[model samples]
Target: MAKGQTIKVEIKRQATPDAPSYTEKFEMPYRPGLNITSVLVEIAANPVNTEGKETSAITYDSNCLEEICGSCAMLINGKARMACSALVDRLLDETKSDTITLAPLSKFPVVRDLAVDRSVLFENLKKVQAWVPIDGTYDLGPGPKQAPQIQEERYPLSNCISCTICMEVCPQFNTQTNFVGAATIAQAKLFNMDPSGSVLKEERLRALSGDGGIQECGFAQNCVQACPKQLPLTEAISDMGRDVFIQKVKDFVSR
Candidate 1:
């Protein structure tokens, strides 16, 4: 490999949800600090494969190019990661391969190419009621205050970008289990710890106790590892698990 050489990229392409998947190999001039999104942009400009055949532009989701939106997650050389932040130099240095591979995240059904329907994560959040409920839009003055200590503890959990990377990497998050994965569980714990949000605590716990609930998590610790936001996922999962268990016990005794 010489300076200013071209980097070969192999991108998986699919025209539609029902279309069969195909691969399109591209060769773009290598640039220092070039990220995956930039490479795709270059491909879009040329729209030619390594074999010099004309091809359709690659389709992928990207918003907030700074990695906050979490929309650019894809399989980069077999690793599930955000395309925006994955540096090409680092990738080349590590893999020692001039060719880069891009593919859609596999855990979810592809909508087109890199885009997949992630509404399941949102729906799961709804199932857990992952929010602080407020009644009467009329101005409620001076809500309960959270101690700094509590705020400090809850802040890390709030960092979840809803990327679904955690879910994608989790073995429990599959069609058979319908497990909600760590992000949703962390959100459950986030809202449950809020003084105002705790009003519906019992209901949230009950929701988690049902099928596709917290019990589904295998505690593989993959979520904690893959979370880009460095959220305290396992801690939240452990805390929520204990709380859900307690709620179940109380329900059993009262019944």
Candidate 2:
């Protein structure tokens, strides 16, 4: 790679939800320390394809311009990753080619270009009641104290940014199955361990035990590998799976 060398990016573009998808190749002048998001910004500044044809700026979601936002997730070189964290040099080296392929997550419905509707993850999170319940916003001073061990156990699960990369890589998260995926399951575990949050543990467990819940997980563990935050997803899933199973037995006996 030489100074001012161009980076070739092939983007799969969709005009709208009902429109046909097509590929567009863009050549961006290389700059040191360029990330995928920066490349997209450059392309947006100069909306011209490789053929010198004027084109519209690419549409994609981005905020914070950091991995913390979890808004810039897309398929880069066929891998689900955050565009903000994906460096151009590293990607070029990894592919061993001049061209990098960019596309929307296949599991999600594309709104336009690389932007996809990721509301499903929020819906799934809601299903598991992945939050601590509070009666009122009014100063509930000095809440319950938790053991150090409990905090240590639940801390990693709390790092989830809701990027949905776990869902995107999940084998069961598809049109055919209503599988809630690993992120939501991990969130349930995180809250269930909370002192106040544990008040709703049975409710959370019951939610996971229902249709399109924890039982639907195929245990492929693709989610654990793909999560940028390196959340203890498999451990959470495993623990939640056991709890869900035990809950089912308890429910059966009570019946």
Q: Give me the candidate number with maximum lDDT.
A: 2
Model 2 earns a TM-score of 0.98
**lDDT of prediction 2:** 0.93
Tens digits of per-residue lDDT for model 2 on 213-255?
9889888989999999999999999999999999999999999
For candidate 2, which ten residues in a row score worst on lDDT? 1-10
What are the models' TM-scores? 0.96, 0.98
- Clashes by residue pair, model 2: none
lDDT of 1 by residue, 149-240 (tens): 99999999888888899999999998799798899989989999899998889998998999998999899999899888999999999998
lDDT of 2 at 8: 95
Model 1 TM-score, 2 decimals:
0.96
Please give the distance, in angstroms, between residue 75's alpha carbon in candidate 2 and its true position after superposition: 0.4
